[model samples]
Target: MNGVAVGVFVFFFLLVTIMGFAAARWRRAKALDNLDEWGLGGRGFGTFIAWFLIGGDLYTAYTFIAVPATLYAGSAVGFFAVPYTIVVYPIIFLFLPRLWSVSHRHGYVTPADFVEGRYDSRPLALAVALTGLLATMPYIALQLVGIEVVLQVMGLQAGEDASWFVQHLPLFVAFAVLAAYTYSSGLRAPALIAFVKDILIYVVIIVAVLYLPSKLGGWDSIFTTANDSFNAFNKENADAIAAGDAAPKAMIPPAAAHWAYASLALGSALALFMYPHSVTGVLSTRSRQVIRRNAALLPAYSFLLGLLALLGFVAIAAGIKVENAQQSVPQLFEQEFPPWFAGVAFAAIAIGALVPAAIMSIAAANLWTRNIYRAFINRDATPQQEARQSKLMSLLVKFGALAFVLGLPKQFAINLQLLGGVWILQTLPAIVVGLYTRWFHRWALFAGWAVGMTYGTWTAYGVPLPGDPDSHFGGPLELFPGAETTKVYIGFTAFLLNLLVTVVLSVVLRALKVPEGVDRTRPDDYTADLGDEGVEAEIDPHEPAHA
Candidate 1:
């Protein structure tokens, strides 16, 4: 909490912003028009840039703060995020190249655009687009949460006696800068800034992990301290469950908890690419081989993530305390790191927020421009118009994320993010399954999305929180009694519901002689590579007359 450290962080934060805006000229694309150029970094990122950009976009500011916070909050389950990152790259290795192939082949910018072209169903594409937009908003908000925790730790926010608006001004300024640069520079800003962001993050985490152990005695002492605290906390939880004092059931046994960890890890690994921002990163690459090479290399970041999650244990051992579980990582750094290093750590956290927030805004805006604005609102829109509209929508999207950050309880960001996963998962049948085959009816996919959204929302609302005033309307559902099998991921659960409805409805719809949408894609299309598709020509239908 050194003011000098805070000043240093502020300096680096501004430095990144200057670099972000300057990226528009760095690669120096001939022109920055259309989704291809503005929204996808000219779709020409080389191996090195792609590695940092995708890593910065995916690992995110939230990862800087929240993952360790969970570890600090008394659950081994939080460590699930690390293994999930490891598992995710291999899974992406299987499908993402295909996705990239199809996207490049068809000049598709968003996954919903792929669905629209594949099935010739505007409604289905719209459904996918809306789901992406919904899922991404809270995610963008969580970036603000990352920055907020850093500011809180720095003692930059107004004291407890200050007005709410006064206390949160830094949060609002952070949002404003993110929105402005993203709108002006699109994906280019974050792509350039990712270099600085990743370097700072690695430095901060490596320094903190190495330096913090001595202050907390040793690794053995740290783990023993953390284990003792967690054990005591669990004992109280056990007593509450035995007394029927807590809602749902007890936390899973350590063994069963491992399954929950593996499942969550695997599920998240599968779902990560389905997110529009991650897809934007995937699609921005110059070739499928570039993506493949990066996939192998990207796991290197997971090693960093593993260490990042361990910081939670570090926090607990250091005896750092915060009212919010999300503050654990920041609090740990504030306690152990020097003022200057703390500033660098805070910059890592702040710049981390900017990278993903920029990409998420771009992804969401691309969806709006391609799927909604062009598909339904203006079919004849030009690439220039598409870029203009996306820029405007990017602003609105960031503002909406800011509103979510300011308007709701802190826990709402977490819940909404989980809810977002549920929403995005509904698109699996339309986006992922449609990649290989179109056996599933397009109409059936729409029905499935509808049912999944309903079930996921209802399930989320029915569960209650621990030690909260409102008992019945807080958290996700517990699936089995006497077991700690709560459904934190309503998306996976709802996807099953969606799949069931889709299968049953497909049968019913086909039996009723429903007119299925035209299928314009072939299996070969999914395997198409760069230089084969003429994506630039397809995206810009009207080439210049002089040319």
Candidate 2:
């Protein structure tokens, strides 16, 4: 390991920490006394800060490492990330502004708060809040995974027969710093640090894409090498099949792993908007126009993602082999770049983790305070008390994410994130439908959520592992064999099930003359533009700016 590269990473991390603390004063709120200022960056982030903040939040350390790793592992299907991100803008443009207006009007901090106010059902709000908190935990842990992998790649943990504790010291120190500043400054810490993280990430990805290919004999050579390796594996499998024997193990070569690649990409795209942190990013913006403008502009990051995905191909060309596919990108950079540059690349990955991890914790905390603690635990909780409870809860959430990384096996956390997508999508019927019209009955919506949750989990669990006797999420949903097939995404299927149940229940309840809850909003409220009297131009002092 080059000491110089390690020094660069340490130096950059410290710089980000200082920035995090300084953000507490950056916007100079009238008062940083409550969740409004602390949790949502005072919700006053203009176009530039919001751009960087959301970009950093959505495209995280895991994206940096895992996207390329999937590519290197021979699953081009992971490129679904690009298309899903592209798809998300239209969806956001449709609903987010309305959410912002209603949330702004009602002092709603969490999406669950919106559910409570709109549906006037404490149970629905609690359900949404609980879902947000559960879904966020593994995502934060994946960030820690990103940082830990970087430290491991740097050989910081490579001492001769070193204990696991000794190897993970740097990772512990890194998160401890994160926990401290986040507890002190809240969402401002991550928003401030995101600037550095995005810049470094862009530089590393661009440089790697250009430099690695030249050393590895260009793009054509890389593809050819991967194809050749893939064909050899396929031929061996075909021969085994021809001999009336079982097919060879699927090594996740580029050709054979296409289904995994496509499914992961598509599933992740749908799941991205569902993450609470992404919602926090959107809600923090100042206007509907800001969200629309950013939606169109954010595809620039997709271009960056495409370039980042090619690093996996670069690893294949370099013939870099490791037990974990995710480590290939960093290892490829380490092999090709000088010590200092490699350190910069590693720092880019590690810092990328911190931006999303911080925002996720804050979002989870808001859900707990607004929907759970306020609704169920203590209806009389004041804003100051709520903020204090949220701050404490945010710390606890971070520790929970840390436990996911340190306590559980890596695959378990990854799988949990996949399950998280299934869980969060259940909220879409309530959140998205409630944005436009409250025609759907609250009870029907709740019933739909229950059906979707059960069906999605059962389907995912029913999938069997490759060659295993059990049938539970071994792979994705396979509609037909050989000739007829669809292995796209299970969440999409679950969402359909949810919508189906909701619609059917709505009709049944309407015939029965069940009382539908009153909607706090009108038609004009959703399509309302900037400067409309219904929407507030400034963030509420009592609530968060992002809300």
Candidate 3:
């Protein structure tokens, strides 16, 4: 192990840890027992804090590691992350402010809280809550992958000769500290620690982008190296593709991958804001203005994301080689930078994993506490009991993620995350569309959700990984149904199918005089600001919020 690198990493990590625990009193709210206080950092964050928090929550360790890894492995298709982030802000701007307004006006905590309040359907709320919890656990598992890769490059975790327990013990120790602080601090831990994570990431990625290229004869040499390597890699894969022995993996996806590229971009954009952790960030902000301003400003992270993606090609020019593509960035830093700076870069990535993991665990815990435990288990838990349960459940969720990474193959975690995106996007028809018109019957929307979830899972299960026909759930790309020649993102196809079913079912159900649920909101509710006074559960049967 590299002692100096480990030393520096430990220093920054411990510093962040201290900051995390202190954040319990950072804003000094009136009480820590309520959902507003514990689940959402008192829901009083201003522009700057929310900016870093949302950036930390959304960009994730995956963006830093996997985006580059994808580029390193497949080429142009990996850059899809950049454009997806660009489009997401504008799209969320259209709906997120309204979600925040409605949720804030009604004192709703989780997205499911809003779903149940808007539709007056406990089952639909439970469906949203369960989906969020399921989607978040695998995402938390993937962060450990980021941490393990960093440790491997730091010489802390390596060699098949090492015992499995010994290899993963460091990771367990790190996450344990994360769990402790998050339990004590709630959302505040991640909100406070995000400052450090984002700063280090920006510094390391910016320096890597500017300084590394000149060492390898600049951008021209970098792209030339990447292109030449891809040519060689593609030539070998061509025969395999002709025999249906491999799926498309290349610099550009060739003629056949256009639909997949566009669909992936669009599907990812739609799904990004739907993640519970992303909504937690949006809801924590002080006002709708905060959400609007950030929509224009947060694209800065997307700019950084694009620069980070280019590091894959740079790794090629630097002659970096690693068995796992995830290790490409960490190993590159270990080789090129001095031991001390390499440690800093490694710490940046590990901390990157920590911030999002903390937020994700909290988000999942909040969902369970509010929508699952309270709604189903007790139905009468006080705010204090809710906070207590959330704190304990946060620990359970993190350890569950630990079990996920250790008990199964890493590919299982990766595939689950892919499915998570698809699954979470299925809720869009119910939650997002409900934010506007309440014309759709709650039961009809619920049925549509069921249909979309079914079709999406079955199709995703059929996407085979080239030579491994027996092992499916390989990637998000699949042939559009009824047109095998066209491959597109499974999530978008599923989302479309979900919307179409909702429309058809709504028309039939409306004609049959199905009873629409009570809406606990008003016209002004959708535009409510931070300090608005409101009454919830106000449903009018004559006008079921048709507007």
Residues 1-547, model 1: lDDT tens digits? 5778978998998898788778777666656677888899777787899999999999998987877877777655677787789888887887888988888877789999899888889989999999999999999999988888889888889998999899999988888888878877778899999999999999888887788887778789988888888777667688675554553222222654555566566667767888999999989888888889998999999999988988988888888877888888877777777788888888998999999999999999999999999998899999989999999999999989888888988887887786677678778888888887787888999999999888877877776666654654354334533565433344567778899999999999889988887877777777777667443322231332111
Instruction: State every prediction's TM-score relative to the real structure.
Output: 0.93, 0.92, 0.96
Model 3 C-alpha lDDT per residue in residues 302-369, reported as the tens digit of each score = 99999999998888889998888888998889888888988899989999998999999989999999
**TM-score for predicted model 1 compared with the true structure:** 0.93
lDDT of 2 by residue, 1-547 (tens): 7899999988898898888777776766655557777787776677788889899999989988888886776553656677777777777777788887777656667888778778888888777888888888988999999998888898877575778777677878888888888888888888889889999988988888888888888999988887676567658678654552433332242454556456555656656776788888877777777887887788889999989987777788898999998899889888889989998998888889999999998999888887888878899997788889888988899889887898988876776777788888889889888887777888889998888888777877776654453535544444423524335466667777889989999999989999877777666666665567756665644544342
**Which wins on TM-score, candidate 1 or candidate 2?**
1
From the highest lDDT down, the ranking of the candidates is: 3, 1, 2
lDDT of 3 at 155: 79
Better of 1 and 3 by TM-score: 3
Tell me the whole-model lDDT of each prediction, alpha carbons only: 0.82, 0.79, 0.87
Best by lDDT: 3
Q: Highest TM-score among the candidates is held by which one? A: 3
